[model samples]
Target: MKAFVVYCHPSEDSFTRHVRDSFIKGVVDSGNEYELSDLYKMNFQTDMTEKEYLRDSNYRTTPGLAEDVLAEQRKINSSDAIVFIYPVFWTDVPAKLKGWFDRVWTYGFAYGEKSMKLLQKGLVLCTTGHTKSELKKYKLLESMEKVMLGDRLFKKVHDAEFIVFDGMTKACDLREKNWNKNLETAYQKGKNLFAPRS
Candidate 1:
């Protein structure tokens, strides 16, 4: 199977990067070909232009910007699975990563006329947070569901199996032993999710 991984993180040494790598390893071990788009590294822009909206009611009309959109569409079109790896910053994904969705998952390209469901075959979300578990428990889970799945992505894609593994506040865990274990488990979950169906 082909897999497309969208990684969102600014720091190269971050736990988010590790988790992304682990997922890639798992996919490779499973003998699947995959592609990756590292948002921060690639310098993805999340802003939507007014002119784009003015042009033909299509979200991606600019020629230069259209290329990026088409590239993402091709990746999505070619893949059987899609994974989003990022660290939850301020209760949301980074702006650059969000921009990838804004630019790539266009109205007509990624969705339209109930045809938008085309992108949802095998989608998974892998995320981490700087806040501790207690913090999340105390709060309302920071509305991750609404922000990530509901507003940004879920509705844009079709019906598919989705899961989350949130590793929190790893900075306090300097050694990262516990964090690594959690990441390993999450990687296993991702692997299982993409394993060939029986």
Candidate 2:
């Protein structure tokens, strides 16, 4: 199986980067192939150009998408599954990734008269500074899931999942305590991503 991994992280000295590496290792160990798009490293353009906005707003399928946007679309079509790895910022995806959705998931491709394929799976792995309980306490987790799984990824993939590694604040004791465990979970998720379940 092949997976397209969209990794968005600004700093290499971060736990989120480690998660990405661990997951990639698991994918390799499972004998699966992957294509990685390190958004920050690639300096991917996230802002939608005026022309892009005009095209989507008018629902025009003029095949005028930018080369970068088309490249991302091609990656999606060529993969069996899609994996998104990032660190949560302000209870939502980082602005870079959100902008990616804005640009890459164009109207014709992800919505009306869509030609995008229904992939086998869509997985989101996000790290949060807040603990899971804290997130649930304010219903932030549910809201995050709704936006990601219920809306953005909705109908775009056959199956989708949102997984967060919480309590990763720099000051939190649990951050260091659970670091290995969190990465192990990430690795396992990658290993079993394409495995059949009965």
Highest TM-score scorer: 2
Residue-wise lDDT of candidate 2 within 23-128, one digit each (tens)?
A: 9999999999999999999899979899999999999888879999999999999999999999999988888999899999998899899989899999999999
Q: Model 1, residue 82: what's the lDDT?
A: 73
Off by over 4 Å in 2: none
lDDT of 2 at 168: 89
What tens digits encode model 1's per-residue C-alpha lDDT throughout 4-119? 88888888877667778877887787777789988777776677676555642654334454666677778877776677787766666677877777667665555553323345
RMSD of each: 3.5, 0.9
Residue pairs in clash, model 2:
none
Error of 1 at 117 (Å): 6.3
As a TM-score, model 1 comes out at: 0.78
lDDT of 1: 0.64
Judge candidate 1 at residue 18 and give its lDDT: 75
- Count: clashes, candidate 2: 0
| C-alpha lDDT values of all predictions | 0.64, 0.92
- What's the CA error at residue 35 for candidate 1, in Å? 0.6
